[model samples]
Target: MRSGRLSFSFTMLMIGIAFLYVPMLVLIGYSFNASPLVSVWGGFSVKWYGSLLHNRQLLDAALLSLEIALLSSTGAVILGLLAATALVRFRQFRGRLLLTGMINAPLVMPEIITGITQLLLFVSMAQMFGWPHRGLTTIVISHVVFCGAYAAVTIQSRLITVDRSLEEAARDLGSTPLRAFWDVTLPMIMPALASSWLLSFTLSLDDLVISSFVSGPSASTLPMVIYSKVKLGVTPEINALATLIIVAVGACVVFAGYTMRRAERQRDQEMQAAYRQPAG
Candidate 1:
């Protein structure tokens, strides 16, 4: 009976993997198709990939998306670090509950509601001050609002496992709280910070609904452009664009894994060497 259960579990796992990956595989294959029809699947060709260079609108949108992602990710990281620090280090502060709720509201709230609320807020601000418009600035700010929530979650999770005594020790040695954090806590949470930054960047890059609501026509993001194209019907060029993105993202993931593994091995070797050394 156990063996049968194991086999069933294995079959289910395989099915799950296929369900997730088969569509991606099909999309990648179609990206190279000579024909424009998605279902027809003509012989392999790279024409669509070549055509991407001349598609200036798509390129502009992609560039704008990158800029927004970069700015929002940095802003998210900074805001997230502060929020995470506050939540983890100062647990008994006034209005902590309210602050925590505001920070995490994006995680639980529906995207449509968040987007509409942000749109309304921007409209109100514009009317009140006439200082800003719905464009890259608004998009970046909206992206940071949600992305910082995710970043805070990631950084806070890492901070939870951190040894507080280390920071205390730094403080005991005449370091100020801010200096202790910089000297002790920051280094330990660098990995989490990096992960949060990447997550923020990815979220901002892939966002559609929020960008669509907040973005001006002059600052349309890549996802908005791709979404419109999909509505018309998926073409080989879009498939090709997706394939390139997949490849780039996959490469970055692989590189990050390799870098992390190498760092881990180096740390392990240092620990072993320290263990072998004579004590004072």
Candidate 2:
């Protein structure tokens, strides 16, 4: 009976894995098609990737998306760190409940509604101040608002798991509060920071609905451009572009996982060594 259940679980896991990866495998395979028509494959070819270099619109859009992703992710990480620190470090504070609600609201809110509300807010700010012309600035702000929430959630969970005594011990050893945080607590949560930053970058890069609502006519993100092109019809070039993105994102995820695992192992070794010490 145990063997039968194990076999069933393994079969279900394999089926789930195939369900998720089969579409990506098909897309990657089609990316190498020699023919322009995505439906008909002449042969394996790298011409579409080469052709992407000359596509000015796609290139520009990609560049813009990267810039936005970088800026927004940085902003989100900074804000998220602050928010998570506030929530975790302070046991009781005025407006703490309100702050928590704001942070988690984006997690449950529909993207379309979030986009629409952000658009309205931006329009009002524009009409009132005339400072932020709806374009890159607005898109970055919108991305940061939502991305920061996810970043905070990631960091908060990590922060909660952290041993506060480590920081307190550092403080007890002639280290100032700021120094303790900088030297001890920060290193422990570095993995969370890295993960949150990567998550924010991916979210900002992939954002379409919020971006479309906030971005002006001039600023077009990669996803927006790809969406428009896909509406026309999927081509080999699009497939190649998508394949490149999947490969790039996959590489980043792998790198992040490796780095985090290494850090964790090192941290564990340090803890073991410290515990073995004779309390010097």
Candidate 3:
């Protein structure tokens, strides 16, 4: 009976993997198709990939999206570090609950609601104080709002788990509070910071609804462009574009995982070596 149950579990696991990956596999295969029609797969060809360079609209949108992602992710990291530090370092403070709720609200709140609320807020602000004209500026701000929340949550989880005594020890030395955090605590949470920044970058890059709401008529993100194209019909070019994105994203995730793993192994080795050392 145990053997039977194990086989069933294995079957379920395979089924789950197939369910998740089979569509992406099919999409990748179709990306090489010569025919424009998505349903009809012609002989394999790389023409569509080459054609992406000529598509000015798609290229422009992609560039805009990249710019927004980079800017928003950087801003989000700064905001996340500040929020995470404040929450972790200051145990008791006035409006702490409110600050916590604001930080977490984006995680729980629906994207549509967030987008709509931001749109309304932007319209109101534009009317009152002629500032932050809609376009790339608004989109980046909108992205940073939600992306910062995610970054904060990711960093906060790591921050809370870190030992406070290390920073205290540094403080006991000549190191100031800022210096202690920079020298001691910062290294410990470097992984979390990297992870949060990547997450924020991915989120900002992938955002559609929020970008749509905040972006002006002139500003279009890559997702917005792809979505518009998909509305017409999925073509070979779209498939190729998607395949490229998947490959790029997959490479990044793999690289990040490998880097983090190596760093962890090195840390473990150092700890083991330290433990083996003789006492003074």
For residues 175-246, write the lDDT of model 1, one tens digit per residue: 999999999889778877987898899889899999998876677899998999999988888999999988
Instruction: Output the lDDT of residue 8, model 2.
Output: 100
Q: Identify the candidate with maximal lDDT.
A: 2
Superposed on all Cα atoms, model 1 deviates from the true structure by an RMSD in Å of 2.0
Ranked candidates, highest TM-score first? 2, 3, 1
Cα RMSD (Å) per model?
Answer: 2.0, 1.2, 1.5
Question: Candidate 1: misplaced stretches above 4 Å?
Answer: 268-280
- lDDT (tens digit, per residue) of candidate 3 on 1-280: 9999999999999999999999999999999999888888789899999999899999999999999999999999999999999999899999899889999999989888999889889989999998779999999999898999999999999999988987998999889999999998899899889988998999999998988988889999999999999898877889899999999988998899899889978987986898799978
Worst 10 residues of 3 by lDDT: 267-276
Model 2, position 145: C-alpha lDDT score: 91
Q: Provide the overall lDDT of each model, using Cα atoms, as 2-decimal numbers.
A: 0.89, 0.94, 0.92
Q: List clash counts for every candidate, in order.
A: 0, 0, 0
- Candidate 3: residue pairs that collide: none
Q: Sort all candidates by lDDT, best to worst.
A: 2, 3, 1
Residue 273 deviation, candidate 2, in Å? 0.8
Comparing 1 and 3 by lDDT, which wins?
A: 3
